[model samples]
Target: MTYCVGMKLDKGLVLMSDTRTNSGVDNISVFRKMFTWQVPGERIITLMTAGNLATTQAVISQLEERTKEPDERDNILLKTPTMFQVATEIGNLMRNIIGERQEANGVKGRGRFTASIIVAGQIKGMEPRLFMVYPEGNFIEASLDTPFFQIGETKYGRPIIIRGYDKQMSLEDGVKLLMVSFDSTLKANLSVGLPIDVQVIGRDEYEASHEHRISHDDSYFSAISAGWGDALKNAFHSLPDYSFYRGDD
Candidate 1:
């Protein structure tokens, strides 16, 4: 399906998502899973999505529409005073969309219409925050105890992050950690193919300090992938040999 991660670091935030969607082995497509909204120096918001493409696209479209027609209704993204409020609004919208689709399709649509999102951003006068919104309109924020969140095909990549994430690390290191995580995921799962989208937001900047699209041929990613594999193999070999059979041998 997809792989999206949002990290809350001391400096700011780092977000990344893969762009591959597949209906079947023969039917595959690429659609960006990352979306961003900004008000220059005032605020910056980023959303990374997973699960049903239709549901996520509809949620984003509705949010954008509200921003354009603020006179007709409250533009939650623009009017919210804090990042917490922004997450609340997005959670409500996503829950409503999924509920409506399920109701329209009746029981036949049970599990087909669900989706989840990672919301990360900052508003003027506030610190950067990160959230993982569930399909049920509930969410959890990242804290010192858990400084990151990953959605969609998460298992294969989670260990790398758990072992490497450091809240005090620089954005550069954050990106490198994410690349290793993503590379591990890509090798194990075909559904998470890349052309990854990445964004780095610096504290107080209220704008993306760096944005990149990494394709399969990217030199740096290639090096990371190869280097990680070699390191893993070396570590496995360097472990002390088993002593259980030493007497028999």
Candidate 2:
């Protein structure tokens, strides 16, 4: 299990994914869930995956290979003229991989090889876009009203995003929001342990403007965790008392 979140903002895009995988409590391991592709000033793309590690890695490896091969093969990086097309290609690949695994496992297959991804990027002339691709090869885009998406162990952290997100928030504030979201998920779910990989792509810059591996010892993330918790508690206590309840008492 893992947690991956992507936000579409007025200024640009922000993405984060954890590096935890587990077969059981004793079989836990760390594997990065984020991947990126860039053509410097022309385009930049980032992917965060969740679900079966093997399937996700295979999908990423296949995309990377297409960009390197002289012979053109249909791939997210090559055949897609736009970010929308790139997402379609990725979705199709995910569905194909899932079907192949199910067939190989025969009657005992639990459909366990499924995976999902969040895709976001900017092309030379277009606005930055964000998408959540599901295991079924279909996806939904993030809009102004619904400005963010998450996969895997998402429920624990979703509330913070819902309450705090704004389309105009700066990249700095966006990163802070994601850090709080991850902190909440980490505290509540053992399956979503951390060492988070984060990347920020600013609009029209066509390269990753900021990227980092945030471990437990990272000072800024530690501060974010502590600060958000204290802020929430103070906010709760500062709220006015219920007058109806007071009269009843």
Candidate 3:
């Protein structure tokens, strides 16, 4: 399991993903869930994946292969004129890969070989965009009404984002918001462990503006985790006491 988030802000985009994967309690491993492609000043794309590792890896592999032989293939990531087209190509590729696996296995019901992705980035002449791609190859983009997307082990961390996300927040605040969400998730679920990968893309930069890998011992994350817990407890205590209760009865 993993926890990945992509935020579309007025300033640019912020993305984060945890690196833990496990088959069982006794069998655990770490594999990066974030991938990026760039053409220097022309374009930059970042993909954060969740669900079946094999399927996600295969999808990324095929995309990379296309980039290597752009002349022989459509290579939508490189050749597409707009971010929307790039998303369409990725969705098509993802659907095809899952279909092939299903046929090979001859299975019907939703099985283990399914995956989802969060695609975020910007092109030279376009605004930064963010998308959440489902296992069925369909996707939804982030807008003013929905400025962010989360995938994999999402429930544990969702409230923090819903309460704190601001369209005008700076990139620094965006990263901090994500950290709180991730910290909440890490505390509640065993499947989503860290060292988290984070990237910030500034509007019009067409390249990564900042990237970070936060480990278990990171002081800033530690402070945020502890501070949130304390704040929650303090808020709970400060709330007005119930008036209907009879304490001595």
Candidate 4:
């Protein structure tokens, strides 16, 4: 399992994903869930994945290879003229991978090669966009009504985003919000471990304005975790007490 989030803000986009993958309590491993392709000032595309490690890695590797080979055919990195097309190509790749794996392994259910991805980025002449690609190769884009998308072990981290998200928030604040969301997930779920990868792309820049890996020993993350916990507890105590009996009387 893993936890990844992509937020679309007026300033740009913020993405974060955990590196942990676990088959069971005793079979935990680290694998980066975030991948990016950047053409410096021309384009910057990012993807965060969840589900089968093999399938996700295979899809990403093929996308990278397609970019290097030249655009004789319509590949994700080369054929997509816009972010939407890129997402469509990725969805198709994911669907194909799932289909191939199912045929080869003869799995009993629809989960063997099941995976989802959150794609976000900008092109030279376009605005930043975000999409969530399902295992079926279908996708939905982020918009005014839905400015964020999450994949993986997402439930534990979702409320924080819902409560704090704002379209006009700065990229820096967005990063902080994601860290808090990740911290919440880490505390509640054993499958989602640390060493988070984060990328922040500024609007129209077509490149990452900030990118970093937050390992277990990162000082800022440590502070955020500790401080957020204390702050939450303090606020809980500060809230006015409910007196149902008095209100009823």
Candidate 5:
């Protein structure tokens, strides 16, 4: 399992993904789930994946190969004029990968290699876009009402994003919000471990403007984890307690 989050802000996009993958309690290992492609001053794209590792890796490998071996194959990832088409191409690749795997493995393989992806980027002269692409090759864009997307162990961290996100917030604030959300999930789940990767793409920047990796011993993350724990304790204690019966005393 994994926990990957991508947020769309009025300023730009912020993405974070855990590097943890586990086959068993003693078999845990780290693997990066975030991939980015960019042509400075023209376009930039970032993808965060969750689900079966093999399927996700295959999809990424194919995309990476196409970009590098453009003479032998079309590099739609770079040549596409719109982000929508970029997403369309990726969705097609994911669908093809899953279909082929299932076909080769027989009926027992259905749904075994499914994966999900969040795609975000900007093209010159066009507004920044964010999308959550399903395993079925369909996707939906982020809008004002839904300004972010989460994949993997999303349930544990979703409330923080729902409560704290504001489109007008600064990029720095956006990063802090995501860190807290990831911290919460880390505390509640074992599969979503650290050495988390973060990327920020400022609107119209045409590339990632900032990138950071949060390691297990990262002082700032440790502080955030501890401080948030204390804050939650304080908040819980401050709430009024309810009486079981009116006028019982």
Candidate 6:
């Protein structure tokens, strides 16, 4: 399992995904969940995956292959005319991969070969966009009402993003918000973990403004984790106490 978030902001787009994948407590592993395609000043596309590792890797490898052989008709990640089209092409690719695996595995593959992706980026002349692509090949774009998208082991950290996200927040704040959300998930679940991958795209820049990884020993993330725990405890203590008796208020 994993946790990945793609957020749409007034400044542009911010994305982060954890690297942990595990079949059981004894079989934990870390593999990068984020993949990016950039054409310098013309466009930049980022994708994060969660689900069956094989399926996700297949999807990415196919994409990489297309980029290498740009003459290939299906080379759309870089060739797609719009961010929306990019989402469509990716959804189709994932759906096809799952379908193929399921057909090959028969009953055994009923639910085994599935995955979801969060894709975010911009094309030079078009507006920056963010999308969540599902195994079914359908997707939803982020907007004012739902300004962010999360996939995989999402429950533990979602509320944090809901409470802190602001469409106009700066990329710096967005990163902080993701750090807190990821820290919360790490503490609650072993399936989602450290060495997170993050990317920030500034509006109209047609490229990534910031991209980096948060390692296990990153001092800033450590501070945020400790600080949040203390703040939560203080907030809980400061809340008005309830009384067992009716007159105690």
Model 6, residue pairs in steric clash: none
Tens digits of per-residue lDDT, candidate 1, 108-171, equal: 4437889999999999999999999999899999999999999999999999899998889999
What digit string (tens of lDDT, one per residue) describes model 4 on residues 186-242? Answer: 999999998999999999898899999999899999999999989999989999888
Against the hidden reference, what TM-scores do the models get?
Answer: 0.92, 0.92, 0.92, 0.93, 0.93, 0.93
* Candidate 2 lDDT by residue in tens digits, 1-249: 899999989889999999999999889999989888888988998899999888898888788664566575544584368999989989998888888888888724348888899999999999999999988899999998889999999999999999999888999899999999999999999988879999999999999999999988999999888898899999998998666556557
**Which sections of candidate 2 miss by over 4 Å?**
66-79, 107-110, 242-249
Error of 6 at 116 (Å): 0.3
lDDT of 5: 0.91
**Model 6 clashes, total count:** 0
RMSD of each: 2.6, 2.6, 2.8, 2.4, 2.2, 2.3
- Full-model lDDT, candidate 6: 0.90
Per-candidate clashes, comma-separated: 0, 0, 0, 0, 0, 0
lDDT string, candidate 6, 1-249, tens digits: 899998999999999999999998889998999998988899999999999999999999887774465665454588889989889989999999999989887834448898999999999988999999989999999989999999999998989899999988898999999889999998999888888998999999888899889998899999999999999999899998877887746
Write the residue-wise lDDT of candidate 3 on 3-116 in tens digits: 999999999999999999999878899999999989889999999999889899988888877556666664347767888877777888888888889889996757678889
lDDT of each: 0.92, 0.89, 0.90, 0.91, 0.91, 0.90
Query: In model 3, how large is the Cα lDDT of residue 12?
Result: 96
TM-score, prediction 1? 0.92
Instruction: Return the lDDT, model 1, position 56.
Output: 97
Model 2 steric clash total: 0
Model 4, global lDDT: 0.91
